[model samples]
Target chain A: MAENPTPTPARPRDAAIGTGLGRVLLLVYGIFALSASARALVQISSHFSEAPLAYLLSGFAGLVYIAATVGLAIGGERGRILALVSCSIELLGVLVVGTLSIADAVAFPDDTVWSHYGSGYGYVPLVLPFIGLWWLWRNRPRP
Target chain B: MNGPLSLATIVVALVLGVWYVIRCALNKAPSNTDLWSMLGLGLLVVVLVVVAIVGLFGPDRPADWTTFVGYLITTIAFAPVGVYLARLEPTRWGLLILAVAALTLPVLVLRLQQIAEVTSG
Candidate 1:
């Protein structure tokens, strides 16, 4: 039995954030970015007076999602830091906003992406930040 | 948007989305057939969108035309975009990407229906 011998070109295992499962994360983040931003734009532009706090929160959430998406896609030291900060903030934002939105309905008459633990988005928003953080931690630079 | 065509699109997308996810769970990267099925779903969505666009000119249009059109454009473009990204990553995760895209389509279509229901009364 002769074993076939051929030089298999070694592909560089660049531990970028936007590779493998990270690519799937990027896609999900991209979808949230578009959706959150578009929803914020519509809410703020059409009726900012209706729910100023909710609309502003929506806008902020959108920016955070956008930052995370960009950071993951870029995947450098700076990008990792950016993604870390944004994802942390995102986790905090969803937790605080989700609780507040439910505890006090008057303040959040309109729903943001983080409202009620992202129930409007099938709770994906609530879970995304955690995933983002895990991905970052998994791909952390070695000493 | 509340027609049989849109319903069919939603059903097809859900079925394909589940199939893709199952395949991914079984550790299968998306094959050509899988990708092509997605493209076929994209074409169906296009037909649904075109029908909605034609209906837009008729009376009793939705009050929020801009948002309606925005969702329409998103729905039409989503599947192909998924196919493109999945092609770039030929792994189980790529199949998950298509799965996510397919699942999101039903939500988008439902949202379109909701927006379209708001006629100027």
Candidate 2:
């Protein structure tokens, strides 16, 4: 068989969603996933009754972060949808929970990742979803 | 966890983190020297984690020993993970990844120190 002389040109724009800058985002998301889930595990296992709502929220946030990380890692049409959903939920979660935690402090005796708009985490939790959404938008599949 | 060692690690990591960020901004991929420096930082982190682990055997132990151990594991693994990801990337973003990892180390180290200070023994 004769070899083709012309090779396919690389298309940076159409590269896998998890490459380049996406990989950097993946690392940050991975860290958050690990930390949030671990924190939830520790809190729920050690003293679930003390702050049931907060602990559950922590677990929920952890799941969201994990989903986002997986979505970024997968990086395709399906991955985009997954990341979009998770990031939206994260943004909403942070805002609603932040407000509730501040407005009704008694209900949230403990801090979740979103409490006080993630002030406890240097507000990274609050900022992360925005960045995730922006990245997703940037990597949207073109027609 | 020795205070001086933690301080040194944090200082070095922060300095390297800044440098990596600058390199990334300049659109530079991670050079061999850059990767090697990260490994060197990783070695420093390994030593820090080892000391912390050995501290666990001493009379005084962190009140939240489980969390401390978890952070120690994460801290030790962080640098190698950064290096691996950066190698796979081979782009400016790779340096940014290293920067993120480098910056996060100080936070982990500080948390470790805070946990260690609250010894129950």
**Candidate 2: pairs in clash:** none
lDDT scores for all predictions?
0.89, 0.90
Misplaced by over 4 Å in model 2 are A1-17
Worst 10 residues of 2 chain B by lDDT: B82-91
For candidate 1, lDDT tens digit of each residue in A1-105?
133388555422323443668778888999999999999999899989999999999999999999999887776777888889999999999999999999999
How far out, in Å, is residue B120 in model 1? 1.6
Docking class of 2: medium
What are the clashing pairs of model 1?
A: none
Off by over 4 Å in 1: A1-18
Q: Tell me, what's the RMSD of every candidate? A: 4.4, 3.9
